[model samples]
Target chain A: MKIAFTAKGTDWDSQMDPRFGRTEYILVYDDEKETFESFDNRDIENEAHGAGPKTSQKLFELGAQVLITGNGPGGNAATVLQKAGVKSFIGAGGMNVKEAYKAYKNNELKEF
Target chain B: MKEIVIISGKGGTGKTSYTASISVLAGKDAIVADCDVDAADMHLLMKPVVEKSENFYSGVVAEIDPDKCTNCGICTEKCRFNAIPVINDQHIISSLNCEGCGYCEKVCPVEAIQMNEMNVGDWYISNTKVDNTMVHARLGIGAENSGKLVAKVKNEAKQLAEETNKHYIIVDGSPGIGCPVVSSLSGANYVVLVTEPSVSGLHDLKRVYELVDKFNLKAGCIINKSDINPEVTNEILDFLKKESIEHIVSLPYNENFTKAMTNGQTIVEYDQGELRDAIVQSWEKVKELVEE
Candidate 1:
């Protein structure tokens, strides 16, 4: 399934990867043949608030089934994700992208 | 009679410290307005005991009543902001995405959508230890209408200055050239652009200076941590001269700034050092310019 991972707070960028530090959105697209593709949030700049709801909307538009991230979904952001039928998982910090997807697929993770 | 606004294009540029120190140095002769409504830190240093506080309601947010609603897709179609969505056979409104345009309520065929007033933030008028009227506010998290809240704070500060017959008002403005910054610069007599010596600092400073110039307000520049990168500092000074903007002062990199921040005080109050003197000199030049 296609998924999007959002980094929470400010410090994780230096910890995970320097490029991820300033990125507002990371898109993981899955194909029917079990292949994966990644896209950066910078690809979409025309939308309002840049990476807030528009990122999630773009992921939903791309048919992303799961979202992996480091921060808890709260405020209006959580509501938007819920409405879009996107499954959000929190506490995914320190985990590699592949491991996060594995845990999510096995239903070991909880929704935010 | 004149107002001076202090703003840094980026956060953590010691905008609040300089503003607080200027307020302290200016003493009772000036009224201070903390216009960084989103994350106002001036109060931490100013130590204002709020003499009066009032709730500010900017506008209404649309609320969806699930009980009275049909699982109508009409609301979603009508919403231009994508604020209304259909989930689990239920129609819901995302409060964060809602612009409070009231379009959702008007387009609801079943009358299930209603607009309710929300308390977005609070504004205050207080007495600081420096013996000046301090006006400030806090914007609710994920809240919109910060520009209006800033405008409200400035209006209150102006009113307070008038009531007390104070001639000058010092405003600590928010970062960036967004709506709140514009609101802070709307009626200002002068603007002090606080900048650092970093590349990003100069970039954002130029952006903010353009904004200040757009409003036709006279502006001056102060380079904080100028010694961190003297080459860049010199470049900034040259740019200032080329642009015909006044270079009020350049403060060297000093640990005293962080130390003062840790102690919840301004550099002037923390240590009577060269940094403090530079800030004082900058304030004096600003005073002279505003008076001119």
Candidate 2:
């Protein structure tokens, strides 16, 4: 399964340290091999709450099955995600990337 | 006779706080309008007790009367917006997605589709504690026609200002440079762009500025929480200088702002300290500039 982590960062450097939309990083996890890769969501690099549906759609298009983020999707965006069949894990704050993936694998996170 | 709109390119940029504080300082001298029809918070700060309100209707929504209709999907085929959907054994129109284009009604073979007006929101004229009339509104959840609501609020504000012989009309504009913002800026004398000292702040500021310039309106900038990152603050200052946009003030990142908000008081009222003084000074300068 290809899972995408929608973090509040733009790059790997800032992705390691989460600060909401100020940082820039979207980690794509390939669950079959238990490995993860990251990409820079340049579109949301400087946006406040940049991990909104627009960026989330990009992640979905990149083949992400699961999205991990701090804030829940907005009303309109949530509808779009439901239509797109993308599962979102909201309120996963302060959890490191590896830990979040582990929780998802263990079916510990609830979908929004 | 000047209208100054306070707007932040993004939400939660303290636009309502600045508008409410300025409204207090300009007490009885201006007509205040909260034009942020979507997620309006100015009324929270202004504490306006609604003196009068009226239900506003945008366009008519098409409602299908299944009792009179056949199972034909003619109405669904004609709707370009895809508002019509087949559910259970009846064809239904989703009211939220309906643009009120009347295409479904026009194409209804059995004439079962009827356009019914729905209340989109409520517009109000209220009395605030500062002895001024405030025009604000609440747009219903999933409601369309926010531009219409914003226009109504601004029109009511202007009417009140003219009737009361007010010198200024202060508006708390919505975030983003969308239809509501356009409606709010229409016929405004000046605009105050409230922004933070962040990369996203500057980016959105430029986007909104472009929209304001498209309307040929004069605007100034205020850097809220300028102390968060001095490097980004300087970068913003340099950009403002390049664009010849006047930097009205640089507000430090102060916890008092949140505290004042929690207490439902303007910063000027909550703390008449240094930050309030700075805001007051900026308002004075803004008044002077707009008057010129």
Q: Which residue pairs come into collision in candidate 2?
A: A9-A23, A9-A24, A9-A25, A10-A23, A10-A24, A10-A25, A11-A24
TM-score of 1: 0.69
**Cα lDDT tens digits for candidate 2, A1-112:** 8876655343233322222222246777777987767776654422212234566577668787777654345444566667777787744444666666667778877666
Please, what are the lDDT tens digits per residue for candidate 1 over residues B1-292?
6678999888877788889999989889999999887778888888999999998776678998888998767878988898987777787988888888898788788999899877878889999988888998877888763555776787678768878899889999988877567667755678898899999999888888877764455789989988899888988998899888899988888899889888988789998867877888888899999876
Model 2 TM-score on a 0 to 1 scale: 0.70
- Number of clashes recorded per candidate: 1, 7
Tens-place lDDT digits, model 2, residues B173-217: 878876567667655667899999888998899899876765456
Q: Which candidate gets the maximum lDDT versus the true structure?
A: 2
Candidate 1, residue B197: lDDT: 91
lDDT of 1 at A50: 23
DockQ of each: 0.01, 0.01
